[model samples]
Target: MAKLQLITPNVAYEQDYKAFYQDWQDSGRAIIPSVAKDLPADFAGYVQRLNDNAQGIGLEEGIVPNSTFWLVNEENNEVLGAVNIRHQLTPYLERVGGHIGFGLRPTARGKGYAKTMLALSLKEAKSLELEKVLITCDVDNVTSEKTILKNGGRRSTDEQTEEGIIVHRFWIDL
Candidate 1:
């Protein structure tokens, strides 16, 4: 185990960005939605895009303002995973999507990083003044369910979206 910390994406993390992206591609997991879309192959462009996203400078329609963080192992400065925290929820979010979205690299799975990263994200959500945050995971993602529960998440409801995916929703009090 290593001491981990969350840091906002920046130019300094280009190498980490590449490595993380490669791992996701290799694993064939559905890409991490917003963070995956518009990721540039070029380093500079990617940093600029991430910066704009964090500042809400230029976002597509229906996308909410969010803060993205990478969980880094402080000892060797390797990226373990990433998380996105929405500032507030829209109607769509209330129904399905949630306040936090997180994923650890395939190589990092089952090492308890998800729970740790999620706990850290919850603190960040609290710092943003969120009294309680909504978090949801696919019905089959047991690891995510456990992480949410470990972080004080209480299951609130389950939804079957038009797309036919069963999503389990939970709320965590700050």
Candidate 2:
């Protein structure tokens, strides 16, 4: 197995990213970390958007500045997954969205990649000067719950969304 590294979104990884995107699409599941959803047709533009979002440039309503990273296998150059780290949280985020959101390609699931992806993301969160971060997963997402626990996340509470979806919330002290 190749070691994985987290990288910022860039045009250089366009092909690998497209494959990663397709894998999620083919899974017929709702993409996580909203940032990875609805990629624009123009790859370059999509990359630019991610970069701009990180810098708090031209943000949309209700959006906070966030950094997005691609988890890649350096040897094979495959984009295995992605993580989005929000610099700050809003009321909604405090309730459910949380500060960190991440997902792996369908084929990459259940192989400990999520743990590494998250551990790496926390480093990025620390670099952003975040002392602590909130992470949330669906109440039924056992895999995520375990991953969070492995990363030193302490269960704080569980929140129910307006739509009545139960979400488990954990806090990681960075």
Candidate 3:
């Protein structure tokens, strides 16, 4: 495999994002882009939303400032995953959003793309002056929890939300 490349949202996909969308769709599974913000009701809906933001085809509001997003690609330039990182933490963010989020496209899971993307994003966060970074994953999301731990994340605490979702919090010291 060629070296993986991670680029910001502004330079995420220079080619066809549709191709990446199609690849994921064809696989019958899709990994949520942590950087994509709110996930739509489902995958199909989310793809529509992704294209809209990707192509500037449409727009969304309240994106955090100084936040950077990226697409992870293969040597062939095929997008294998995506990630998002914020330069600073906010109130609600400190509890939930954390300092970063990430995911691997469905078709690309188990290939360690999310891990690579995350490590790369952490480096970027350090560049942005983050001394320690916080990341959270749903308690049941073993895959994500492992991903967090794989990136030097230590278990922080568990949070129970009003909506009832249990989140496992972790922090990485850069």
lDDT of 3 at 120: 89
Model 2, CA-based lDDT: 0.92
Q: Model 3 residue 35 lDDT?
A: 44
Ranking of all candidate structures by their lDDT, best first: 2, 1, 3
Worst 10 residues of 1 by lDDT: 30-39
Q: Using Cα atoms with residue i matched to residue i, what is each candidate's TM-score against the true structure?
A: 0.92, 0.97, 0.74
Give the per-residue lDDT of model 1 (tens digit) for 1-174. 889999988778778767887888888777664575345868777667666876787888988888888899988778878888988999998888899998888888888898999999999998888999999988888988999999999998566463787899999999
Per-residue CA lDDT of candidate 2, range 45-116, in tens? 999989999999989999999999999999999999999999999999998889999999999987889999
Residue pairs that clash (backbone atoms under 3 angstroms), model 3: none
Best by TM-score: 2
- Give me the overall lDDT of model 3: 0.68
Which segments of model 3 are wrong by more than 4 Å? 10-15, 23-31, 34-63
